[model samples]
Structures are given as C-alpha cells and as structure tokens.
Target: MSPATALRRNSDLGAALAEARAAYAAARPRSAAQHERAREVLPGGNTRSVLIYGPFPTAMTRGQDCRLWDLDGHAYLDLCGEYTAGLFGHSEPRIHRVLHATLEEGINLAAVGQGEERLARLLCGRFPSLAQVRFTNSGTEANLMALAAARAFTGRGTTMVMRGGYHGGVLTFPASGTNAATLPLPFVHAAYNDSDEAARLARAHAGDLAAVVVEPMLGSGGCIPAQPGFLAALRALADETGAVLIFDEVMTSRMSGGGMQARLGITPDMTTLGKYVGGGMSFGAFGGRADIMAQFDTTLPHAGTFNNNVLTMAAGGVAMGEIFTPEAAEALFQRGEALRARLNEIGRQAGVPLGFTGLGSMMTAHFRQPLPDRPYAASPAEEALRELFFFDMLAAGIYLARRGMVALSLPVGEPEMDRFVAAVGEFAESRAALLRAGGIAG
Candidate 1:
C-alpha cells in the first residue's frame, strides 16, 4: 500500500499497528515466521530482549554503507546502526580490509598484539585527559574499572552520579544512577540537569565521595541533555570534595572531535568508552590520570584475558585511523545537522513537539509536552505511549532506542538521510493521527 493510504487508514494505533504488521509482512514475512520458530529456544525469540517488540522484528540479513537489507531483501536506511556502534557505518572499507587481513593472522590471543598499542595510541591522542588507558571487552567492564580505580585512588567508599544515567551492564554499572540498588559502591543519585541538587548531594557526601560519574548527555533517560552549567557544577563539586570525576562517554563520544566533554569544554577526570571503538566489533576502555591509573598495575590487577583481543584491535586501528581524521568528524557533524533539521521540520508540520539531545552525530528524539510539564512524565499513560512510539517507528522501517533515541552513523549520506526523513515524516503523521483518534491521551 502507498504511504498516504496507510496514513489515511491509521487513525488509531489499533489500526496503525495492524497496518504496521502488514508493512512488516510486506518487508520480511519470512523473517517474522523464523522469529516465531526461534522464540521457543530464545527468551522472547531473541538473544537480546530489547530487540523484541509487538508484531515481531525484521531479521537483518546484511548491512553495508548506510543501508540494511532484511532477510526478505527489503532495504532500509539504517539509522540505529546496531545501537550507535556502527559509527563508521557497516562494512567500512578501511575496517573491512583490515579485519580480513587480521583474521588471516588470528582472531583472539592469550597475549596482547601490536595492534593493541596502535588503537591505544589513537585513543590517548584523541583525548588529552587520558594519560593511561586500559582495555576491556565492553563499556560495562570499562565503567567497572573506572569506579574501582576511583575508589582505590581516593580511599573512599561512595560516589555520586546522576539519576537516570545509564553506564553499562551488571558486571560494571548496570541500569543507571537512577536505580540506586544496582550501584556497586555507595552511590548517591540526584535528578539529572539540576546542578544545584547534584552539588548539594555531592557536598552532603563530600567527605566520603570517591567520584562523581555522569553521562555528558543522558543517553537512556529519554535523550535529555544535561542542563547548561550542570556538568561544570559537578566538576567543581568533585574538585571541592576531592572526588574523582568520570564521564561515561561510551555513547556520547561520537559527538565531538574529542568527545562530548571536549565539545562542551568540560573535562572529567576519567572517561569510559566502547560500542563503536572497535569498528564494528566489541571493545571497551577506561582511562585517565597517570597517578590514579597506576593502581591498575600489580596493586589491583586490571587483567582480563579478553581485555584486548587481536581482531578487535585490527578493526579498531582501521576505525580510529578513519575517525581521528578531521574529515570524519566534519562528515559526522554536517550529516547530523541535516538529519536534525529534517526531523524538526517534519514534527513541526505535524504539530508535534520535537527536538534532539546530544551533539553532532548522536541525536535522540525528544517528544512530549514542552517544559514546565516535566520532560519525562512517569505517569502510566506517558510510559505506555513512549513504548508504543518505539514499536510504531520500527514497523515503519525505522528503529529506535528502547528509550526512543536514534543514533545516526556514517553510512547515512543524502539518499539514506532522505529515506530516514521520509520515515519520520510518516511517524509524525501516524502519531498525530493516533492522538486524535484517542489511541493516545494525555
């Protein structure tokens, strides 16, 4: 069916969802059938539960450049890009050629490889704050090490982080600072974007705080950027309290030339990174001051067999070789502006409140009533509507973060960007129609 016809019929989500199911059928009927068969062995029929949603998900068969092809051979402009790790885009030539070369040599080794130093050199050079760096298998492990080093350095038991700040997973920093129970150390979480409260709480635990860790932009908390001066205030509090500061830039590192903190001109004592650092492979790292990082030596073993695998190093070297160049950053920012503009325009015409959080290539959609009503309402209706938005977008050939953020990657040039804009444009109309039909209610 034509998009206009689908839009006309989808006056409510009940209808829109049915139309969405039809759209999915047209795109990957086989994938949906396969997903049903796989669900028996896999919880929710997926290795990653987040990938599962109503009407099922299309299994992507291949990705190259800025496009993804499903099992049924339907093409889509890949805006999600494996949750932002495909920053250089799928099968980037440099990374592809290098990984293939490395695989000929080996994949993982018990001992480190020369490529480890190559990737490390690029990281330290990119961020001047990093005097020493330690590799890990994922961002979750990186944050765990960051926290451990902070505690050891300060000899303090507690730390401060923002509420709704997502770091990584259980072995490290699972959930966010918002979920108080999961914090490994004595963590104090204050509402995000409120510098006054952060300062107050950090100071309250001043004598005991080892660090104040936060995301420069809250990635999972509805894509809300921290309010202006918020980060600076945390920095000051950390200094006054003698607490180490950490910037969990695993997601936000794609923003600036140096990282989000560099672009914002606010420096944290340490930073955690992963996701895209290994080209398209799994890799993670935490690095900071020479004195603090020395603890990672014999004093506290930062040793892990898989910390710096060989293949990831090769792919990462290629990724960094491309990323560290001025051209790569410029391409990211320029593309970012275009995507943001298109989304804003589409949402505006549809009478939807639309804006983005994060800088440069990492733009996440912000939809809801304007300020004074609270950016993220915890009401039941608001919660369900937010979840519903995600499923709707996916069915329309657009994937979104479980929290409704969208990360743009390198492969998305003009053609892919136009396709994405078209999807969002359809999303705007579909959402507006849903609201008018009482499928959604404030």
Candidate 2:
C-alpha cells in the first residue's frame, strides 16, 4: 500500500469508529445520564476499572437467565458472564433456594458453622491439590493468604510472579510498568509462557523466593493459555528452588471440576479459588499440601470475619455438589471449545483479522491475526478495532467486555451461541476493509 492510500484508509477507519461511537451514544441516552449521575459519587462513575470504556458504559438494570437489560431498556445476550463469576448465570434456582434458606436460617451467626466443613470437604475431594483449605471473602484475599502461607512455610520473603498475571486487585503485575494499587512485595517478574525465563528468575532469587505465583491461563490478561511444557517447567523450578508454586485458579477453575491443574495433571503446592465457587456470591479459598497449610494452624494468622459466612458456604456446597457437577463442568468445557472453534472459522472464512483465545467457557476476542502470546504484543490499531467491535456487538444485542472477553454462562446454550456467532460474522463482513487496513489481516 502506498503512503497516500494508507493515510486514506486510516482516515476512513477513524470515521467509521467515530460513527459507531456516535450511534452508541445516541441509542442510550438514559445510560449516559446515569453515568453522569454516578460520576457525582463515584470516580469515573466506576468502581471496577475493567468495566470502564469510551462513550461511557451502559448501566445494566437487571439480568435474568443469560440476558441483561441496560438502563435504556435494551435487552442483550450476556456473553460477559460477570467476568466468569456468573458461571451459573443469573437466577439459578438451586442457588437461589439455598441462599433463601441460608438467609431464613439467619446471617452473621458469628460462630463456626457446619456449612464451612461441608464446602471444604467438597472442594478437597474435587481438587487433588487441596489437602487442607481456608476460605476468604474474595480471590484477592485468597491469593494474599496463599502467598502469606508460602512465605511463612518457606521462611522467605520474595515472590516470583508472571508478568501480565493478575492474582487480585492489589496483586496485579502487568506486562509493563506497575499498578500503583499493587501490594508492595519483593517481586521478580518473568514473561508469561516462558518457562526458561521463569526458571532463571527463580534460581537467581532462589534464596529469598518464597512462592512462584502464576495463572494457568492469563484471564484478565487476554485469556492466553499457558503453552505446553510452560507450567511443567514452573513446577520443576519451584521444586528445585524450594519455592511454593501457587496456581491462581480463580478464573480458570471453571475449566474442569478440579480446575486446570487437574485437567493438565500438574499439581501445584498451593491453589487459590474464587469466582463461581461461591455460587455467584462473594467467596475465595486457598489450600494445598497439608504440611504447608499447617503453618496457618500454628504460626500464620489467617482470619476474616466473613471467611466462613454461612451464605457462601451453603451456596458453594450446592453449586459444586448439585448444580455444576463433574459432568456439567466437562460439558461446559466442550461447549466453549466448540464455540471458540466456530468463531475462529468464521473469521477465517471472512478473511478478517479477528480471533478468540481461551480455554473452556472463558475466551477473549482479539482483532489481530496470529494472536500474540502476551497482551503487550497487541497493537494500538488492534485495540481501536476491538473498541469498534464492542460497539457493533452491543448494537446487535450482544454484551461482552470492552476488552473483548467472553465468559459463557450455564444459561447460554446453542441458541445464544448461534446468535453470538452470527453477530461476529456480520461484524467481520461489515468491517473487512477497515480490519485489513489496520494491518491485522494475515
């Protein structure tokens, strides 16, 4: 392409994106007004950073099944699934019944409840790595406690974490720079999916490295799956360095009944759980080899007022035991696998530079061909295209993350999947020229 032609194409792409944003803003006046109102009390009218996007986010009114109604009264097929926390979907009858029963029984019992033991037993039985477990209020707290246990057990202070890994709000390590909100810890960051680099870092800091934390699949960091041999390498490194390997399965736990660790046959020293494990309620858990977790019993102090709250415990027990059984987990994994393949096939047939990466009911769309192994490799042009795609999908009554993430819920079946695929096909056909010009085409 000539310089003049490239310039013209870029101009056209800008206009196209501008037109989409204008249409998005025009269609949802009420949402815009609500955002303005929220800005009075909330910073950027948002508490969660990931939900914020340009032209403002459409404030959701309610969700039923797999559908959500925005403040403007537009109904959408909810593909975001609350970032994998809504695996059971909105209005799961089993969970609701359990929650109602728990509420009727009473909340804030302020005592050790039988529900905690039931849930813990269920978790330990399902996941092989969990010889013993402790609960928390969220995944962040679960990871924090897990790291604390590692440090206490190993008698070391430094942690080795993967770059672009997100353990929690305060434990995030992006590919570049640092998150101001990140907890102040002695951390040595290594590239994701690069086992050699991880090994080197672990060996270099072996003496002080208490834990090597990693996500089986980078969740918020674009759903990039760990390549073959990557996790095994980390396992070996942890053994050699005497560092506790902590797998952050907060998001990827949905990959199987026992999580990615079980699915891949690589057990970590410690594992953290959250999201759907709470039956869509606030919950988190960290557990591992009894020997390491024994520190909590003796030296380490792990305490949270709501850690054993009856509601989460009751719902989680039912969620794992009754609702999302081992069979259901496997079925969802197959469903997601088929959906991802179909989406990629559509992109290929359309000759568009769009694809999805992820494993089993959790995936992220990217406006780039031959998707990179890490988030930092995504280009700014691709990001612009992703933003445009977000608007397009929203207009078509499909809801996903602005960052192109999709977490399929139990309520999302064949019909919803078909609609999503059709929407993607339409977007590819409509934006073929712009996508190609953005240099994302193969």
Candidate 3:
C-alpha cells in the first residue's frame, strides 16, 4: 500500500480503538467508580500490572463455580481462570472442606507439619522430576530458590531463560521496558523453541551456566507450548553441560496428572510449581532429584516462615490427591482440546486473522494475519488485534486476559464453552468492517 493509503488505514484503526475504549468505559460505571476509589490507596488502582488496562480495570466482587461478578453487576464466564491459578475454580467442594478443616485445627504450627510431608509425597509420586521438594509462599520464591539451589549445586553464577519467558513477578523477561520488575541475576535470554540457538548459547556459556530455566509451555508469554524436540534438545544440552535443567511448571502443572513433563515424556533436573497446586491458596514449590534437593541441609539454609504452613499443605494434599486426579485431568485436557478446535474452526469460517497457541486446558488467542510461526515473536498487527479482542470479549461477557490468554477450569463445561464460542462468532461479525480494513480478518 502507498504511504497515503497506509496513513488513512492507521488513522481509521486508531479511531475505532478509541470508540471501543469509550464503549468499555461507558458500560462499566461502577467499575470506573471502584477504580477511582482504588487509585487513592493503590497505585494506578492496581496491585498487579496485567490486571490494569486503559480507561480502568473492572473490580470483581465475587466468584463462584466458573463465573465472576464484577462491581458493575456484569457477570462473565471466567475464561482467564485467574491466569491458570484458579484451576479448581472459585469453589471446589473438596478444597473448601480441606481448607476449613485445616483452619479449624490450626494455621501456622511454627514447625514442620505432617501435612507438608503428605503433600510432598503425593507430588513426588506424580512428577518424576520431583524426587524431593520444598514449599514457598509464591511461584516467584519457588523459582528464586530453585535457581539458588542450581547455583549452589553447580557453583556457577549465570542462568539462561527464554526471550519471552515469565517465571514470576520479578523474573520477567524482555518486555517493552515498560515494566521494571526483574531478577538481578545474570541471565542469558534465548529464543523460545529454537533448540539450535539455545544449544549454542548453552555451549557458549557451558562452564558458567548454573541452570537453564524454562516453562514446558509459555504461560504468560502467550500460552505457547514447547515443541517436543526443543524440550528434548534442552534436556540433552543440560546433560552435556552439567547444568541443572529447571522446568518452571508453575502454570503448566495443571496440564495433566503428572504435568507437561510427564505428558511430553521429558524430565528436567529440577522443577518449580505453583498456582492450583496449592488448592487455590498462595503456594509455590521446587523439587528435583533427591541428590540435588538434599543440599537444602541446615548448613545451606533455605528459610521461609510460611514455607510449610498447614493450610497450603492441607488444601494442596486434597487438590492433587482427590480433586485434580489423573482421570479428572485427562477429561479436562480433552475438553480443552475440543474447545480450542472449535475456536479455530470459527476463526477459519470467519476468515479472521485469529489463531490460538497452547496445550491442554490453556490457550491464548493471537491476531496474526496468517498466524505466527512462533508465538513469542508476534507482529505489531497481532498485538493490536489482541488489545481489540480483549475489549470485545469483555463486552461479550467473556473474562480473559488482555493478552488473549484463556485458561479452562474443571467447573467450566460444554455449555460455557459453547457460549464463549458464540461470543467469538458475534465479535467477529460485529467487527468485520474494522478487521477487514486493517487486514486483520476477511
């Protein structure tokens, strides 16, 4: 297209986005009020950056089953699933019972609890990489400790992470420099799923590399699953270099009974976990071969006051042992696959630039013109579509991340999935003019 034509198209797209923003603000008067009130106490009216968006974020009142009610009295089918932490949904009966029982007994015993051991045992039996484990307050801590352990074991100072990876709050990767949160540790950022480049980096940093940390599937970085070959290559490189391979399964653990490591049949030296593993509580864990984890001896000292608290242990025990069993997880995975297939079909039928990337119950929609060769490296067009889709989906009563992430929980079923699909169809129809003008859809 010529410069004048391109300029006109850009101007039109900007106008449409402005209109959508206005519509969003007008629809959520109560949310806007709540955000204004929150801004007085909380910076930008948000504790989490991702939860904050333009015009203001909606203040959710309560959640039950698979639905969330916002301050505006707008109810939504929660496809974001609290970014995969709400795997058990808002109110899983088993989790509620376990938590209540634990609360009745005691919260912090101020010592090592038997419940921790029980949960640990269950985790060890399920995840082959976890021969022994240690608990933490959040996924960030789990990753921190895991990296520390790898460094201690290898006596090295450098760690390697993927380009678009996000291990935790501070462990963010190469974003637009808009966020300042990050680990101070020396990190060699490599491309996701590019085994050759990663292998080269690993070999180059061979002697000093302490750990090669990665997500089996990129969770916050657009829900892209690692190609099997890429994972296997990393495993081989770790073996060759004597570096500990740490799989950050904080989000991907919900993929199956044994998590993605099991499903992929590739094991890592150490694994970090969080999210629904705590049975909807604040939780994180790191574990690996017994020999490596054994270094957590008193001499080395890994300390956290609430690391082995009874509440998380009690709830987690029930979450893994009873609630999200292998059978249940398998069923959920199947349902997710079906939902994803249907969504892709709708996109194809509508001739939209919409696409999805993920595995099992986790997925993210992308507005790639012809879909991306890799999820991490997205075009500007894809990014713009993601922003537009977020607003459209929210208006349609489907709560998802602005990044287009949609995570499925056990409480969601066929009816909810159907409704979500229909909403996507409607959004496509309504936005056809804008989408076509921007070359985002037919």
Candidate 4:
C-alpha cells in the first residue's frame, strides 16, 4: 500500500473504533450511571484493574449457567469466565449446597475441622508434586508463600521470572521491569518459552537463585503456552542448580485433574494454585516437596487469618472431589481444544491478522502484523486492533477481557461455542479492508 493509502486506511480505522466506542457507551446507560456512583467510593469505579476499560465497563447485574446480564439488560455469553475462577459457572448447584451448609454451620471456627484435612489429602493425592499443602486467601498469597518457602529452603535471595509472567497482583512482571506495586525481591527477568535463555539465567545466577517461578502457560500474558521441551529444561536446570522450581498453576490447573505438571510429566519443586479450586470462592494453595513445605511447621511463625475457613474447605473439597472430577476436567479440556482449533482455522481462512494462543480451556486472541520467526510480540497497531475487537465482541453479546482473553466454563456447550466463533467471523469480515491494509493481506 502507498503511504497516502495507508494514512487514509489508518484514519478510517480510528474513526470506526470511535464509532464503536460510542455504541458501547450508548448500549449501557444503567452501567454508566453505576460507574459514576461507584467512582465516588472506588477508585475509577473498579477494584480490579483488568476489568476496567475506557468509556467505562458494563456492570454485570447477575449470572447463571453460562450467561451474564448487565445492568443495562444486555446479555453476554461470559466467555471470560471470571478469568477462570468461575469454572463451575455462576450457579453451580453443588457449590451452592456446600456453601449454604457451611454458612449455617458457622465460619472461622476456633478449631481445626475434618473438612480441611480431607481437602488437603485430596489435593496431595491428585497433584504429584504437592506432598503437603498450605492454604491462603488468594492466588497472590499462594505464590507469595511459595516463593518465601523457596527462598527459605534454598537459603538464596534471587529469583528468576519470565518477562511476561504474572504470578499475583503484586508479584507481576508483565515486561522487563517490575511494576511499582510488585513485591520487593531480587528478580532476574528471562524471556518466556526460551529454554536457552532460561537455562542461561539459571546457570548465571546459580549461586543466588532460590526459585524459578513460571506459569506452565502464560495466562495473562497473551495466553502463550510454554514451547515444547522448555519446561523440561527448566526442571533439569533447577535440579542441576539446586534451585526450587515453582509452577504457578493458579490459572492452568484447570487444564487437567492433576494440573499441567501431570499432563507434561515435569513436576516442579513447588506449585501455587487458586481460581475454581475454591469452588468459585476466595482461595489459594501452595504445596510441594514435603521437606520444603515443612518450613511452615506449626512450631514456626506462619499464619493466615482465614487459611482454614470452614466454607472454603467444604466447598473446595466438593469442587475437586465430586464436581470437577478427573473425567469432567478432561472433557472441559477437549471442548476448549476443539473451540480454539476452530477459531484459529477461521482466522487463517479469513486471512485476518487475528489468532488465538493458549492451551486447553484457556486462550487469548491477538490481532498482530504477522507470524514472526521469533516469539510473538504485539505491535502498536495490533494493540489498537485488539481493543477494537473487544468492543466488537461485546456488541455481539460476548464478554471477554479487553485483551481478548477467553476461558471456557463447563456450561459453555456447543451452542455457545458456535455463537462465539460466528461472532469472530463476522468481526473479521466487517473489518477485512482495514486488516488487510494493515498487512493482514487477506
């Protein structure tokens, strides 16, 4: 395309996005009012930064099965699935029953309950690495404790992390630099999915390295799965260097009943877990080699006010043991795999610069320039296209993260899957001209 043509196409794209943003704002009057009211109390009318977007976000009023209804009366298919925490769907009956019973029985009991032990035993039996476990309030806490354990166990201060890895809120390293809110720690950032880079970092910092923390699949960071053999290399490196390997399965645990470690056959020294493990409740857990986890021995000073809360214990046990059985987990994984394959196929056929990256039950769509010989990196144009796609999906009655992330819940059956794919097809067709001009080359 000529420079003049490119400039005109860019202008058209900007205008189209502006019009879409207006349509989004106009569709949710009630949500706009709610946001205004909330801003008085909550900063930016949001507690979670990921949920926020320009022109305000639609306030969801209720959810059931696989759907959500915003305050403005717009219904959404809820492909976001509360970022995988709502794996059981909004109104899972088993969870309801357990929660009700636990609530009636009272919470924060002064005594240890059998339910807690039962849940721990169930987790230990399922995940090979988790010989012993400890509970926390959220995935962030789980990761925090896991790292603390690694440092204490290895008697080292430095930790190696991927550039795009997100362990917890304060433990995030989305890029080369740690965010201001990141916990103070000696961290060495390494390129994700690059076994060579990871190995080099591990060996270079061998003496100071306490742990190598990573997500089996980068959930928040564009849903990129670890390259084949990358994880095994990390396992071998950790073994060679005496560094603790911590798999932050806070998102990828849903990939299998035994978590990703079981699927990959590469067990880490420690693992952090959260999300639907708590049965759609507030929960986090970290556990691994019994000796390393033993640092939390009752004789030592370690505590969480609600670590053994009765409701979470009871509900989590049912979630893992009864509700999300091994068979159910495998089924969900298959469904996600099929859906993702179809989506990618459609994007390729359309010759749109759009694609999805992820493993079972989790994925993120990106509008990029083209496949690079190296690891994927989003360009500025791709970033704008992603934001535009978010609005397009929202208009089509699908709810997903602004970053185009999607997670399949058990309730997302064939009908919902078909609709989601159809929506993406429509979006690509509607924006074909702009996409092709931007190097999509359809």
Query: What overall lDDT, based on C-alpha atoms, would model 4 receive against the true structure?
Result: 0.87
What is the per-residue lDDT of model 1 for residues 1-442, given as tens digits with 9 covering 90 to 100?
6887766555555555555567656766788888889988988888765577666777888877777888877676677767778787776778878877878886656886788898899988887578889899988889989999999899998977665667775522333323433655677767777887888898788889998888877665555676548888888888899999999988877776578777788878999999998887989999998888888775988878877888888888878776546567767877887777777777667776544555567666655434211135444434444556665666666655755667888767777678767877776675775544432222
The true-versus-predicted C-alpha distance at residue 308 of model 4, in Å, is 1.4
- TM per candidate: 0.88, 0.96, 0.94, 0.95
Better lDDT candidate (1, 2): 2
What is the Å distance of residue 257 in model 3 from its true position? 0.8
Model 2 spans with C-alpha error above 4 angstroms: 1-11
Best by lDDT: 2
Evaluation by lDDT, superior candidate among 2 and 4: 2
lDDT of 4 by residue, 1-442 (tens): 5777545534577776777888899988899999999999999898999978889988998999999999989899999999999998999998899899889988778788998899999999999899999999899999988888888889999999998889889988875445888988999988887888889989999999999998998888878888659889999999999999999999999989899999999999999999999888899999999899777784335588888889989999999999898889999999999998998887789877777888889988866634321235566667768888899999999999888899999999999999999998987877777666553432
lDDT of each: 0.73, 0.91, 0.86, 0.87
Evaluated against the true structure, the overall lDDT of model 1 is: 0.73
Distance from true position, residue 48, model 4, in Å?
A: 0.7
Each prediction's RMSD to truth: 3.4, 3.0, 3.8, 3.2
Clashes of 1: 1
- The top-ranked prediction according to TM-score is 2
Task: Score residue 97 of candidate 2 by CA lDDT.
Answer: 95
Clashing pairs in 3: none
Write model 2 residue lDDT over 1-442, tens digit each, in one string.
5776545434577877887899899999998998999899999898998878878989998999999999899999999999999999899999999999889999999999899999999999998799999999999999999998999898999999888899999999988889999999899999999878887888999989999999999998999999759999999999999999999999999889899999999999999999999999999999999999888878889889999999999999999989998899999999999999999998899887789999989999888778767757567788788888899999999999888999999999999999999999988877788888774655
Candidate 3 lDDT by residue in tens digits, 1-442: 5776545434566655766788899999998988899999999897898898888988899999999999879999999988898998898888888888888987768987789999999999999899999999899999999999999999999999987789888999853342377868888988888998999999999989999999988888878888899999999999999999999999988888899999999999999999889888899999999888889864368889988888898999999988899999989999999888888887788776676778889998876555543444555655666678888888888899888899999999999999999988876766555566554442
Each candidate's clash count: 1, 0, 0, 0
